[model samples]
Target: MASLSLWLFSGLVLLVGLERVAELIVSNRHASWAFSRGAVERGQGHYPVMVVLHSALLVGAVAEAWLTDRPFLPALGWTMLVIALGSQALRWWCILTLGNQWNTRVIVVPGLPLVRRGPYRFLPHPNYVAVVAEGLALPLVHTAWVTATVFTLANALLLTQRIRVENDALRELAVMS
Candidate 1:
């Protein structure tokens, strides 16, 4: 049971890493397309920090669980696993709905309108919501409470800046459109 839980937790982290890489690939393509038409990226100063923080988060979660020999509580672990999976679905839904407009960074194309379909219809930043859910749930899956707490706090700071930048960019684009 313990071995199985560890395997499940490890698999989850691996999938998340792969998903992030895939998102970056698509983001790069979208960024190029946006830039070709005069889109401007905001929050460049904080981008590197965001990348590092997220990378460290995954690494920390794995390390904390393995090094500390964290025991997975079935109730907590299974519940968190469900939340993590649900978040992944939400994240992908955001990506598909946004289509080519979705990018990791804030690249606002002039004269383009805000996306209001699918999940966006319900929340302005559903992707971030998914991020928050996964960040909290993933660490807790293996009882990595420190990792969960740390990542959630750090992510809150990062998201505050990111959402501010995104909203400002969108507001500017709205005027142009």
Candidate 2:
């Protein structure tokens, strides 16, 4: 059980690291295009803090999973794994759809229209769905219910602000379209 926890934590850390790298690359590309297009950036204050909090949640989940060694039902682990994978898929889909537009920060491309196709056609915030799924199930995969519950509650609060910023930015873009 301890070994599993270590491995799970390590894998998650690596996954997050890679995701950050992707975000940086995408943001750099977006920056060049958006600036050239005279896009104004709005509400960037909470972005860095949010990134830190999200990373902390991943690390905390890993720690809790590693420190505790309660035997989890195999069925539960499998179910959580499935949910986690689903969340990852959703996240990657968002990344693909947004391309250079997808950023971890609050970057607004003034003249560009808000995305309404793909998953966005349904959920206004498909990224939020991915976040919720991840916050709930990632820790559960290792039977770290404590981590899951606490992080989910925290993320809910943080997401409220995040969504508000995103909505405002998108709304600004919507006026032109």
lDDT tens readout by residue for model 1, 1-177 = 346767778888988999899999999999999999899888898899989988887888888998788998999999998998899999999989998789899988888878899999999999999999999998999999999999999999999999999999889875433
Model 1 spans with C-alpha error above 4 angstroms:
175-177
Q: Report, for every candidate in turn, its global Cα lDDT versus the true structure.
A: 0.90, 0.77
Best by lDDT: 1
Best by TM-score: 1
TM-score per model over all chains: 0.94, 0.87
RMSD of each: 1.8, 2.2
On residues 1-177, what C-alpha lDDT tens digit does candidate 2 reach at each position?
257646855596568667767767877787777767776676678777777777777887777766776455579877887888898889888878877677776677776777877888898889889989988887787778887888888888888998998888877764534
**Residue 13 of model 1, lDDT score:** 93
Error of 2 at 68 (Å): 1.5
- In model 2, the number of clashes is 0
Q: How displaced is residue 156 in candidate 1, in Å?
A: 0.7
